[model samples]
Target: MDIDRKKSTYLTLGILFMILLSLIRWGGETLQYLFYLRVPLISGALLFMLPIICIYLLPSMLGNLFVLKNKWRMSLVIPGAVATGLGIVIIGGIIGTNAAARFNVSPCPLLEALLQDDALTPYLFALILAFPTAWAAYWSSGPASKEMSNTDRKIGVAIGSILSLLLMGAIYWARTGETVSWVSDMLLMIISILPSEARAGLVKDDQLTPGLVTASAFLAVSTILYLIGLLLYRPKIKKDRWQLPALSYVLGLLLIFSFLFGLLTFVLDYYRVPVLLSFLAVSALAYKLWKVDHYYDIRPTPTEPPKPDDFIGALKERLAHQQGRRTLVVVCASGGGIQAAGWTSMVLTGLQKRLGKDFTQAIGLISSVSGGSVGTLHFLDRFGNEGAPEDSELNAIFNASTEDSLGATGWGLVYPDLWRFSGLPFLHTQPRDRGAAIETDWKSFMKSPNATLRDWVDPIKQGKLPVPVFNATIVEDGRHYLISPMTFATEPLEGLEFNRLYPQHDMDASTAALLSATFPYVTPITRNSEEDDSQSKVTPVFHVADGGFFDNFGIVSAVDWLNEQVLPKRVELEIERVLLVEIRAFPDEEPLQTASRKNVGFLMSLFGPLLTVLAARNSTQAQRNEDIVNDLKTKWTAKDIDIFDFKISFPKNIPFFEIPTQTGYENIDQYTTALKDEKKAYTPPLSWTLTKKQKDAIRNAWEILNQDQSSSVAELEKVWSRK
Candidate 1:
C-alpha cells in the first residue's frame, strides 16, 4: 500500500514539473507592471552570455542527457527536457501576448506590456546572441563539435567579461540608497524579466527599470562559474565523479535558482503537499495496476553501528571513572538555520573555554536539531584537541556555510534533481541533493573523529566527549528522530530513534546534523529504510524532515535522557548536580494574548490551520520543557542533586553597515552605540549561504551574554569547578 521510496522522488519531481511550467508562464506575463515597459540595453548583454547557460549550465550539468552511446536515454532525456522548457516558454509568450493578464497585484495602472507581441520578441532576443547560442547549441547537441570553437570561446569571454563588468558597475552606480535591501531588490527586479521567474516577493519586489540590465550581471556570474567549472571539472571527475564538478555547477545554479525561485516561490512556493500526495497516490495506483514491485535502491545506504556496543553502559562506565560525583551537563541546541549554528558554536566553545579540561567530563549529552547539529560538528572539529576555538574558527564557519549551500541546492532542485519525473533515476549516479550541498562546506571543515556521527561514539564512551544527538523529525509522523550512535528516548516528544529502527544504516555527521533542519521546499526530504521485524523481507522506508517541526528547542530528548538515563542512575553513578545548558538561537517571543498570532490575510485564513498547529506545537514545547525543568527541580530537590538550567540566547545583529570587515571588533557593544543603527530583523538568514559580514556579525554578537536571566554563569562555573 505504501508508495515505493524511489517513486516518491518521481512524485515530488512530478509536482515540481507540473507547477513549475505553469507558474513560470503565468508569473512572467502577469506583469507586476510596477516598472515601465522598457527595451533595456542589458537584455542584449544576457544574450551575449549564452555560452555559459547554453553550453555549460545546460550541457555540462545536464548534457549527460545527450549521452553519445546510449540511444534510449538520449531519445527520452533530450526531447523531454527540451519539450518541457520550450512548451513553457511558448505558453508564457502566448499568455503574455494574448488575453487580459490577471493581476493579483494592484499597485499601478496597466502600462504597455512588453510581451503583447512576443512572436517577434523571442526571435529578437535570440538573434542578438545567435552566434554564441548557436555555437553552444551545436557543440552540446551531440558529437558534432566535441572540442568547441576556440573563436566562439574567445568571443564569449570578451563579450561576457566586458559587458558583465560594465553591468555590475552600472548596478553600483544605480543603487539610490545605501541599504542591503536596495541592491537585493534591484537584483530581484532585474531577475523578474526571466521567463521562469514570475511572481515576486522575497523582500520588496516592485522593481523599476534598469533592473532588467542587472540580468547580465547575473549571467556573468554564471559565465564565470562555468569557466571555473570548465577548468576544474575535468580533473576531479576521475576521483569523485559527478560530485565535485556538480558542486560548482550547483553553486552557480544555486545563485540563479535563489533569485528565480525566490521570485517564483511567491506563487509556486515549494509547498505542494496536497498536489504531491495526489501525484503519489495516482502513481501508486498505476504501479499496482501494472503489477510493478519497484526495487530501486540507489539512495545512499546508512552506515552500520559499531560492533559490541552498549552506548549507555559505556557512557556510565566512563562517567564513573571520574574520581568523585560531579554536575552532569546536558546541552539542548535548537534548530534555527545558521542562527542556531552561530549561537551553538559560540556558546559551546564559550562553555568549553570556561570549563577548560572539565568540559567533556561534565557534559553528559549534546542533543541538537538541524543547524544546531551543524554547529555541534564544527565545535568538536575545531575545539576537539585545542580546548577552545580561535576567533577565526568561530567566524570561518559562518562565511563558509553561506553561499556554497543555498544556490547549489536550488541548482539541484531546478535541473538534475527534477529528472526523477522521467524515471531516469540512474542518470544521477551520485547524489546532487540539498543535503549533499549542505554537507560540502561542513565536510571540508571537519575530519577524523568529528567528521561523521559514528566517529563521535568511541570518544564519548572513552570518557573524552559528550554524546551528540542530531534530532530529525519523521516526515510521516512528525515525531522526533534522533540520529546518533546510540538510540534516543522519543516518548513524550514522540521521536523515532534511527539507531534502533535502522541499525544497519549509520549516518555521516553532516546528514545527521541537517536531517531535521530541512526547511520546507528548500531542503530535500531524506528517505531511510529498514527491514520489517515482523515480516522477513518487508523493508519499509521512512521520509524525515527537519526536527524543528516537532521541537525546535530540542529539549524533549535532553529531558528524556536526563529522566531515563542520568536521573535514574544518579545514585549508582555518584552524580551531583544536573546542569542543563539550553542554547536558544531566537530571542524569547513576547508572550501573546491568544493561542496563535492573528493573521488576517485570505491565504492565511485558508492555509493557517496547519501552520497555526505547528506554531502552537513549538510554543507549547518551549513551555513543556520549562514545566519539566520545574518538576525535576521539585522532585529531585532533596536528593543532594541540584538542577542548574542555564539558557543562552544570541545577541542582536548589528545593521549591515555596522558589521565590521577586517578591522577587529571583538564584540558587538565594542562597535560603540553611535555606529549601531537599526537592529537586523532576523539572525543571519536560515539560508545555505552566508556573507563575511554576517559571519563576523555572528561572532562579534557572541560577546553580549551575561547569563543573569536564569542560573548565573558564575554559579554554572561553580558547578563546573565542583569536581
Candidate 2:
C-alpha cells in the first residue's frame, strides 16, 4: 500500500516536472529577449510569436516522430517539413534579393554582414540562447509526438529560432530609413502573416471584372456554409449527423453557385473560368463522397478465444457436432500438400488394404484460393474471421497452385500428355446446356470397369471433337500422327500448329510419356486464378512450368471423391491442417536489346533501377526484424505455433511492488489504514492468475522460510521457483 502510494506520488511529480520545464523555457525566452538581448519591444513581440508557432507545431511533430519509428514511413515527415521550410525560405530570400536589385540596394545587407563577421559574436549569442530554449521546449514535448527524434527536436527548435531571427532582421532592414508608411506597413504585415493570400489575385486587369465579383460571391457563400457545416457537425446517436452529409450540403450549395456562374458566363460569352470551376466542384464532391462510402464497408472483427481443451478433446468435440463436411489439403499442385496427403493416404491405404475396399467412405476436398495467387481471398471469403472451424464435418482443405497463364497453358498441355503417360480414361460429362453446366455431375462420364480401353481411348486417340474420349490426337503428317493427346472435355486450339510454337521441346522422355498417357483422361479445371495471371506476365514469368495451378473446379470434384469414395474405401487418412507458405517475387527485368552489346547493357541498366525499387518495396526489414524477435520469444515460451498471444505468465514469487517494506515503518496499520480510510488511495484491484497447487505451495514456502511471517530473501527465492 505504501509502495503504490509512493508510485502515485512519483507519477504526479513527473507530470508536474514536465509542466515546469515548459514554463521555464517560455519564461527564459521572454525574459532573455526583454532584458539581456535589449532588442526593440516590437522585435521581441514578433520573436515571442515564434514560440507559439513552435508550440502549435509540437503535436504534429511528435506524431511525425512516432511514424518515423515505423520503417515504412521513417524520415518522411522531418524531411518533408525541412524541405518545405527550406523551399519557403529560399523563395523568400529570392524575392528579397530581386526586390533589392530593383531598388539598387542590398535588401539583406545586415544578413550578409553577419555571415561575413569573423567573430560572429552577436549571432553566436543568439544561437546559444535559442538552441537551449528550443531544446527545453522540445524535450518536454517530444516523447508525446510522432516522428520526433531527440536530435531532431533539438535541431528543430534551434533552426526555428535562427530562421525567425533572420526573417525578422530582413523585415527590419526593409522598413528602415523610411517614413514608415502606415498603409504599406499594414499591407506588408498582412502579406507576411497571411502568405497564402498573396496567391489570390482579384483584379489582375486593374478593373472590377465580373470574374472578381463571382469569386467574391463564392468565397462569401463558402465562408457562411463552412460556419454552418461546423455547427451541424456534432456527435449524435444517429449516424446521419456525421460530417460527410454536412460537407455534402455545403458542396451542393457551392455546386449551385457554380452552375449559376457558369450559366451567366455563357450568357455573357465568358465561359472558361465558370465552366472549369463548376466541373471541378462537382467532380471533387463526388470523389469525396465515394471515398466516405468505402470507409463504411468494414470486415468483421476477430472472435474470442477458443475453449480450454487438449487437441484430441477439441477435435472430438468439433467432429461430434458434424454440422458439415469439407476437405483440406496444403495446396493442389504443390509438393507440401501432396506429400502430406500422400503420407496420410499411404497410412490409410495400409489400414484399408487389410479391411478391403468398402471399409473407408465419405471423403471430399475443400478447394481454397491459392495462397500465392491471392492471399486476401481466404481472409475475404471468411470475412477475415480466423477461429476454430464452426462447421464440424469439414475433413480437409487444400491450398492449390495459383493459376497463371503458364499454369493454364500448362494444364492444357497436361491433358494431352496425361493420356500417353498414364492410363486414366477421360470422362466428358458436359450438360446439355453449356451455360448451365454443373461440375458435380462430371462423375457420370467415368468409364465403367467393363468398358474396353480401346473404346474409351478412341475419341481422344482420333483427335475427334465433341466426343467423349480418353485421348486427343492431331495428324501432322501423311503418316498417322498424334501431336498431343487430350481428354474428352478438351477445348481444341484454333489455327494452333500442334507441336510447333512453344513446342514440347523441353519435356524429358519419361515426363513426355507420362503426360501422353494421362493427358487423354485429364481435363482442364478452372479456379479463381485471376490475380495470378496478371502477375505472371510481369515477372520471372509466373507459369504452369513453375508449378502454379489454380484448381477451384478440380477441388469440388476432389472433395466429392474423398467424401464418397476415398473415405469409404479407406484410401487416405485425413487430419485438418493449415498450409503455410510465403510467395513473393521480384519484378521482371527489361528485355535486353539485341542491337549491340552496349544497347543490351543500357537496357539492363534501365530495368536495374526498377528492379531495385521492386526489391525494396517487397522487403519487410522492419516487420521481419520485429517478427523474428517475437518468433524467438514465442518459441522460448513454447507458444510459437499459436501465432496469437492469448496468455501471459507472471512469476508467483515476485513481490507485488505495491507492498511497503520500509525499515522504520512501525505503524503498518496507520499507513495502510490511511490509504483505505482518509486519502482514498485504492483503485480497482488488478486481476491475477495462479493454480491452487501453486498457491498452496507458495503459502507453505512463505511460512517455512519466513519464521516471523514477514517477507524475506529466502521466501522470495522459494516463490520464484514455482514455475
Candidate 3:
C-alpha cells in the first residue's frame, strides 16, 4: 500500500485504541472517584500520559490477568482480604469507646490516639508505609516478565510471587507493630515511583515507598543501555544489523506517543537515540563505499571502433536505402552567412519535388548576423505569429541550428551578373535563377585552376560553387564590420549620412588598384526603371573599401583581387581614407548622387519568400524569422559602410543634359510638352534596335569573356551568330 493508505489505516487503529483505553479507564476511575473525594477517572487519564504510568503499567494489568494467571497475586485481591481484618480492629476500637466505663478502655481516640502512643512511633510508621508499597515495584516488573522466554517467564513469575508474599508478610508485621526499621522506610520510597505504585493507588496516598532507589537505579541503567544499543544497532544490509521493518515499528510507536502526549525530547532525550545513532553510522559506511568506488570505471568495453566502409558506392547505396521520414541538409560557413542561401535552394527544391508545383508553401531566408526577418515571415506562413527575431523562438532556433563545426558547407555562389554588376554589397543572386551567372563563374574557376584565387573566389561565386559566402558590405561609412544585414539596414546612422558620401571623390592609386582588381566579380548590375522589365534578373556583387566590385558581373579575376588585396587592406584604407571622407562630407552636403540601383524594393519583394525559405532551412519557424531580418538588415545597411549604393538601372540613350529643365516660369503643361518634344527628338531608329538573335549573341559573348582562359569568346560568338 502507499504511504497515504498506510497512514490512514494506522490512524484509524490508533483512534480506536485510544477510545478503548479511555472507556475502560473512565468507568473504573468514575466509580472510584464517586466513593473517594477526588475525580479518579480524570486523574488516571492524566497519569496515563506519564512515562511510568502509560509506558509500563497499562501492559502490566494484562500480564497479571492473562500471562500471570493468578488472581491472588493482584494487589487489589490481597488488599481486599486484609481490609475485612482492618475493619474488625476499627470496630473493636469503637466498641471500646462505647464500653469505656464497662470495659475500662476508652476508644484509642479513634485510631489517632493509639497511633500517638509511644508504641506506634516514627520507625514503626515508616515500616508500615514500606510494607504495602514494596509490591508496586514488584508488580511493575510483571509485564516485562511476560515478554521473556518460557524459562525466564516462569522464573520471573516465581521471583515476583516471592517478592509479593514477602511484601505482604511485611504489611502484616507492620499491622501488628512487628517490623519497624529504617531500611524498610528507604525501600518504601523506592517502590512508590514505580508504575505499579501508580497503578495500585499507593503512590497517591503520600506514602514514601522504599522501591524508589531501585527504580531510579533501573531507569539510569536502562537509559545508558538505550543510548549504547542505539549506537550499536546501525542499519547494515547484514544479519547482525537492525532490520528496517522492526525499526519502523518501534519508531512509529514512539512518533504516535509523542504526538498524543507532548513527549519533549532534548539533550537527555529518551526517543530517536537509536535512530539517529544508526543513521550516522550508516552514513559513514556509505561515504566509505563512495570513496572506494569513486574513480572506478564501471562502464564496460573501454572502446569500440567504428566499422569502416569497404566501398564508397556500397556506402552510398546503403545510405540511399535507409528510409527516413524527413531529411536534413546542414550548411556551415565562416559565420554561417552564405549557408542561408544554400539552405534556401535545398528547401525550395525539396519542397517542390515533394509537394509539386504551385504548392502554397512559404520559403524563408535568414542570416546569422541579422535577427528574424526571415523566420518571422515563415512563422506567419506556418503558425502566423509576429514576434521580432531577437525576442522570438524563431531566433533561438536559427542560432542553435547554425553549428559551423558540423562539416556543413555554406552556399557562397557568386554569379557573373553579381561580379560584373556594380553597387550593392555582396553577391545577391538567388541560387535557383542565376543560370548565366553560375555558368560563367564556373568556367572562370575551371579555366584558372588557381588554388589561392579558387579558395577565395569560390565562396563569393554565386553559382554552383561549393563554398560558404558571407554578407559583407563596404558601405560609404567604413567603420565596424556589422555582421547582421538587418541590423545594418535598420540600425540608426551612427557616424555618417548618405548624402555626404562619394565613391570616387578622392580615390588613391592602391585604392584604385584594389577597385580595379575586384570590380569584375563584385559589380552591381544597373537596372534603369524604364529599360528593364525583367527586374528579377539583377543580382548583387561583392564590393570593398576601394569603391569597386570584387567580382563585377561574372569576372573571377575581380573577385580574386578583392579577396587577395583589397579585403586584406580593407581596414587600413577605411581608417585613413574614411577619416578624410567623413571630414569632407557633412550630413547637409549635397547628397552624393546615388546610383539608381535602389530596385531592391521590387527585388526584395520578389525574393522575400525565397529569403524566408532560406532562413527556415535547417531551422524552425522562430529561427527563420530571425535570420531573414538579420540578413536583410545587414545587406541593406552595408550601403552606408561601402558608400556605393550604385543603382543597377537599365541603359538609356538620353543623356542627363538632353533632358528639359523645369523652371518656375514653365507651367506643368509647358514642362510636359518640352519633355515630349525631347523624347521625340531623341527617339532611336528602328534599324538600330538590336534583334533577339543579336541580343542573345551579345549575352553569350559576355558569358564567354567572363570565363578565365578555357572557353573562347570567339567560339561562343560563332555559335551565337549561327544560332
lDDT of 2 at 441: 15
For candidate 3, write residues 1-723 as lDDT tens digits: 579978998999999998768756764433222222112222223222332342234321111111121232233222221222222222222222222222223323443242222333322332332333223223322332222233443454455446444543443344324123343355456645455512232232454222222222322333443344334432222312221111112222232222212211111122234433554565556546543110100111222211111112211221232243111111111111112212222222222343332121111112111111111112221211111111233322322222111000001112212222222223233221122222122222121212221222212122112111122225444422212101112223322111112211121111111122221222221111112237674222222321111111111211222233322443433311110000000011123367345545677789878866654432342244334434533543463322111111112222111222432234543744533334322121111011122222222332333342332322322322231
Say which candidate scores most in lDDT: 1
The candidate that wins on TM-score is 1
Candidate models: Cα lDDT each: 0.52, 0.26, 0.26
TM values, all candidates: 0.59, 0.19, 0.14
Q: Residues 115-176, candidate 1, lDDT per residue (tens digit)?
A: 33222343233233334433333333332222224354344345534543453343334333
**What is the model-wide C-alpha lDDT for candidate 1?**
0.52
lDDT of 2 by residue, 1-723 (tens): 479978997999999998768756873433322221122222223222333342233322111111122211222222222222222222222222222322223245432233221223333433432332233234323332223455665555555555455533433343322333343444344434433323122122332212222223323433454445334432222312222211122123323333333233322222124544555666556546542110000112132211111212322222332233312211111111212222122222221233222211111112221111111111111110122211221111111111111111222222222221222223221121111111111111111212221221222122221111111112231111111212111123321111232222221111211111211112221111122247544211111210111121112222222233333322122332211111111111234455344434557678878766544533433244235435433543352121211111111332211122331235543654432222222111111111122223223433343343342323322332231
At residue 35, what lDDT does model 1 achieve?
Answer: 20
Model 2 vs. true fold: TM: 0.19
